[model samples]
Target: MLRIAGILLAGTGAAHFAAPQVFDPISKAAFPDDTRQWTYRNGAIEVALGLALTTKKTRLLGLAGTAGYAGWLASRVRANRGASQ
Candidate 1:
């Protein structure tokens, strides 16, 4: 289960780096030109956390990764309010 989740994270992170423009219009505050850099940084973090989640020696990293993912999702929801809000 952990490995699957990790792979999902890494895959999405790769997509972010490879096609950041797909994510650009969702932002509420970031400048247009800075989006790709932001995407790449996020991709790096996701890849790192995903890698960290792959072993018992670093199991604690899974907790941190979960927290980070939760926070990231919450932020996206908050920042992209529309008729649902």
Candidate 2:
């Protein structure tokens, strides 16, 4: 399970770097003035987190990744709720 999660994280991280345009809009909506910078930062963070997840000594990284993902999810939910109302 951890391996699969690690692979997925790495894949998504690569995708973010490989195609920032795909995520730029979301960043723009969240932070209008600095979308590009934030997008790149997010991608870099993901790459680091994914790499850490692949190693046994980096459980802290996995925990951090989970926290980051949860924060993203929460933000998305908040956005959705605001949009619906």
Candidate 3:
């Protein structure tokens, strides 16, 4: 289960970096400057989190981080929606 989650995370991160244009709108709305950088940074972070999840020593930490990351992203999306409105 953990391995699958890690693979999924890594895959999505790879997708983000491979085709960042798909994330441009969210990046632009969530970041104040250099939206491209934000996109890449996010991709990198996801990749790291995925790698961490694959390691037994870090699996718990990685799961916590993943949850936190998801929550943070959701908050950002909500904030962006409010700002755009």
All candidates' lDDT scores?
Answer: 0.67, 0.73, 0.83
Model 2 misplaced stretches (Cα beyond 4 Å): 72-85
How well is each residue in 6-85 modelled by candidate 3, as lDDT tens digits? Answer: 98898888878899999767677776467789889888889989988987999999999999998888887777765643
In candidate 2 the C-alpha lDDT for residue 37 amounts to 85
lDDT (Cα, tens digit) per residue for candidate 1, span 15-79: 77778777555432333345567667777777777777777777587768769876885776566
Instruction: Identify the candidate with maximal TM-score.
Output: 3
Residue 6 of model 1: what lDDT?
79
Better of 1 and 2 by lDDT: 2
TM-scores across all candidates?
Answer: 0.66, 0.70, 0.81
Worst 10 residues of 1 by lDDT: 24-33
Task: Please provide, for model 2 over 28-82, each residue's C-alpha lDDT reduced to its tens digit, 9 standing for 90 to 100.
Answer: 6555556688778777777777777777898577868768876984686566554
**Candidate 2 Cα lDDT to native:** 0.73
Error of 1 at 22 (Å): 1.8
Q: Better model by TM-score, 1 or 2?
A: 2
